[model samples]
Target: MRSYKAKSVTSIQLPPRERRETVLTEAGHNVFNLAADDVFIDLLTDSGTGAMSDDQWAAVVRGDEAYAGSRSFKRFRETVADVMGFDRVVPTHQGRGAENVLFGALLDDGDVVLNNTHFDTTRAHVTNQGAIAADCPAETDLTTDTVGTFAGNFSTDRGWDAVEEHGQDAVSAVVLTITNNSAAGQPVSMANIRETAAFATEIDATFVIDACRFAENAQFIKQRDPEYADTPLSEIAREQLRPADAITMSGKKDALANIGGFTAVRDAALFEQCKQRAILYEGFPTYGGLAGRDLEAMATGLREAVQPPYVAERIEQVATLGDLLRDRDIPIVTPTGGHAVYIDAAALFPDIPADQYPGQRLVCELYREGGVRTVELGSFAFPGTNRPELVRLALPRRTYWHEHLEHIAETAARVRDRRDEYSGLEIVWEPPMEELRHFSAELEPVA
Candidate 1:
């Protein structure tokens, strides 16, 4: 149920370039043999469920052993362990599911979760558990004080303040998002993560990494840091991950080829307890609601996720998009970390009132005009109402190439030119169609 308001909006009628039509697949309609140069990138969706190698399919086709009897759980456990060096691993259906099971299991009433910034789902999970999610203003001091919005935002001092104000018992954990999505795809340096993790440990609280884009974060760090110039990407990621007591990953983005998520913990007791909750919400402790196929793809994807070339390629593509957007003075979060291009709508559309946040305005306008869809990162995603607005353009994982970027850039240029026209009405949304979910914004888009 979407709410709609009758407002005249600008329209862009450019024909989207077509790349490839099809790729052979046993799953038929379920998979798209996406050419590397497709124009319409699916940013609003998850990583596609493309078909995997014949051997991968065979592994999935043989599920029983993969799930329980054979050291399937152990193998997956060791996979997580070898990389993260965590004592135990507990697989779940997806990242949010892992968040739900883990938070629900750990948080009681009045606990607090502190993070540099938060993803929508993570905040909702904390709130749902009757816990408070607080942000410690972090600033990424890459250079001097001229800190970028995305960087230097995760500060250790603020984290200390949070725990000092709210006693250790009141603070359940400090969760760090690798590529802090809400903060414009900005990644925390290994130094920041380590300091934050150390601070959390000092307060006797659990440290968790929302490692949805761990590999991307690793690339950003390596490219940005001189000290890490010689270190391998895998080693850097493992080091950042080592400080956290547990990690929650979205398989769709970084681990599995398709959709799924898993959580791992270093403490034996915590791992056992989290696994027990997984049985309740997820599936059995062994498989945890994933199909045989998903488990197999995930196994392969996890291995590929750490490969330097695989990680580097995706980061490069996203960086390309970011560079293009920035070149046009489109108000993008420059020095883009990895994975996405974040447009600072407020800066771009300064005249638009905060009450009618221009970012939301642009999102609606772009969709109506070019049939391009994107998620709005604004107050709606935050716990409290009236937060700053931002528009996030999540690059489709390993999809599209130079030509696809041209279309996106063309669309953006058109949108920029027509920004004034869309700003005319200053359309303010009425009550939302859906109750405020975390990151998702369902609004009334009327013509």
Candidate 2:
């Protein structure tokens, strides 16, 4: 049972089947393009979609809106330092903003950034700076039936090979995304983190962690890694960051806030450089691009995020949903993930080739069948990439309950039963940017 009660509620209505079908066609078959009011259960993303706690709301009211050196910024900085063990915290409007600031300052033309697997925006930001974004995922089978505790680990072997392939001097940074988002929200092991950090040191590259879901990742460590079974979430979180030279976070995820993120560093010189970049792109260093209230809420959320009860319940909820789908014989990535349940769209639609976008087809069918909105993270999201075709049902923190999850599972079962009726999707028009075309690309049923 939850330790808290709902203080407020929002009304949601499921649009009729005909209306949903029309909306899908009008939105170019892209869930990202769907209007909010037209959907029943919105699961397109967990970013900035979670509901805040009462404490966060109280902090928001006490926020100091000063232009620079605000009280809220100091509190936020202190909280981040306390929880993440970083002295310098520069806020941003969101996670991508932190990425922009960090990459803008650290990356140059012909540079390379390596990660376990770069989510859509992270890869885009690295490539946007004219740098090569390389993925070094651990050698593990990510098929639906393959189960593991820490499949999100980075392959040090692959990282070393990449460094050699593109001269060591060309490598600028090695990033590890905690609870690897692109790899079905799996958690990275502490042992792997230490090994990857050592590898980064050997290569003389900055060890950066994309820590959007840091707390959840830490909780996973406590549960899965026997060494940390007795450790507190806060200490685990600190240990997770201790190896990183710097971190870029999207506060939207673990921070439990609506908006705000930060790029934190241990080196004062590098911190100054990131601050200067923040000034140029975001607002002043203190406020970055967010309101003071956002900083206050983020601070409170950071504290709340690491508490044992909150993290355990949050992770368990996701696992519950995964179990629901699995009981129905749905092909889902196992042992489920921290924030979302990844459905193997390729397995679901074996006849639909990668070029036809099976993942996107599933996304469309789920919406049309049951008013549940989801996003594709396969060929459509990462064009030409030889990765699993997945549809992520990202659950927002504290926003859903058992019934909501059941509805989602029932919806998936309904669609799966009539899977033969669904076909593949073909992109009719896409943007010039090849990396992020899934966000706005227009598509249609492949006839």
Candidate 3:
């Protein structure tokens, strides 16, 4: 089973930094505002932070940089088409850029979009375009105690219900985010996908897949379900893509590149409209706000990502971190997600009141104590009292090793030792009616 070694052909060491008395401040109460050197192990997110392979670097060097009809864009477009099963490729700077182009082309005011769980950007973009976003998680009987195998499934009945309630004329799309990020990185069942596709067709609604983490989702399907135990990762992924009329993808995650994304579609009209929008906002359809080399790197990375060992090892590394935290009796999202381990912040900081922002405290403390930087997925991101509170530790691909995670595990145990001591944080400044405010929301430890 082991045919090749993955040792990095490069050396790494700690970058120089000026020791600071504290990582927090009146200005930088949030971890997002922290200086890069202050964070020793940055698990803030997996997006656009992964290490590109040597082969990708080679591709980057050999890329064509023409302003129009670039050969690099052609290569990138062909690769995504072959791997993702889309005939038309419209590149964008990142996932959100793709979303902006696609949503701008497809959705209008008063249109309703359904998602299993909408991540922050997805929801913001929907409402930004004057559309309504509704979440329909798999289980109507959702409980916090037990974690289901496919917690990411979209309810088949709910999709039909949305179409019926709003009238098919008002329903724009049904989106399934692979390894649903908002609900923790859980995989959707193939059965669920097929069922949803049928519902979309019945209502004449577009089935748009948010495939940012498509490869990892496929690996989980093989590992969790016996029916696909022997299927190739890429083919299983293709099956997931089969019923989709359109897709929004982030080259930042599974593509193993620094930055780039694309919107691909089978609907010819939508394809042309998306291209028009991409040009207006992003750039020429060829570059689409990306350097030609970035597109080339994405082309190679997408191909390398599906190879068995690469993805298998990638998910395995994340599980190892989750396992470490579990062995310490720390609570986490069960069946650790493909990309990250989520800490149950509510349980971790029970002493801190919800209004005081306990999750924010945990996030800053990790940075202040162990130089570990992570992001809060609950109140800070959602700004809701009813939403589940979570601290996400998203590992970048090929960027970190076990020793780094071991240090993080030990650091988390240190934080857990004083979890009771954290009084919590309270926002002192927030933007007026901002759709997204976590980036600039100023907070202070509750006095």
Number of colliding residue pairs in each model: 12, 0, 0
TM-score of 2: 0.99
Instruction: List model 1 lDDT by residue over 1-447, tens digit each.
Output: 111222333232433422121221111211122232331344544344322334445556655445563455555666676766665666778888889878977889899999887677787789888888888757443211234533824677888788779887898888889888777778788888888888888888898999878887887788878888789988987887988888888877777366677888878888888988998899887777776566666766676677787778777777788778767767776676577776777776777766555666666555444545565676444525444566777776555557767667666777888776755222223334222442232333223
The full ranking of all candidates by lDDT, starting with the best, is: 2, 3, 1
The positional error of residue 175 in candidate 1, measured at the CA in angstroms, is 1.0
Q: What is the TM-score of each candidate against the true structure?
A: 0.83, 0.99, 0.94
- At residue 95, candidate 3 shows an lDDT of 97
Candidate 3 per-residue lDDT, tens place, 1-447, comes to 322446565453343332422546744578787777556788999999888887999999988888889999999989987888887989999999999999999999999999998888888899989998888777722223447888889987777777778888888888999989877787898988888899888877899999999999899899888999999899998889989999999999988889999999998999999999999999999999999999999999899888889889888888899889888877788777789888888888888877777778888877766778899888887875356778889998888777898888887888899887778788888876455777778888887
lDDT of 2 by residue, 248-366 (tens): 99999999999999999988988999999999999999999999999999999999999999999999999999999999988999988999999999999998989999999999999
Tell me how far the alpha carbon of residue 17 in candidate 3 is from the true structure, in angstroms, after superposition.
12
Sliding window of 10 residues with minimal summed lDDT for model 1? 23-32
The alpha-carbon lDDT assigned to residue 246 of candidate 2 equals 96
Task: Report the CA-based lDDT of candidate 1 relative to the real structure.
Answer: 0.67
Best of the candidates, lDDT: 2
Query: How high is the CA lDDT of each candidate model?
Result: 0.67, 0.94, 0.84
Best by TM-score: 2
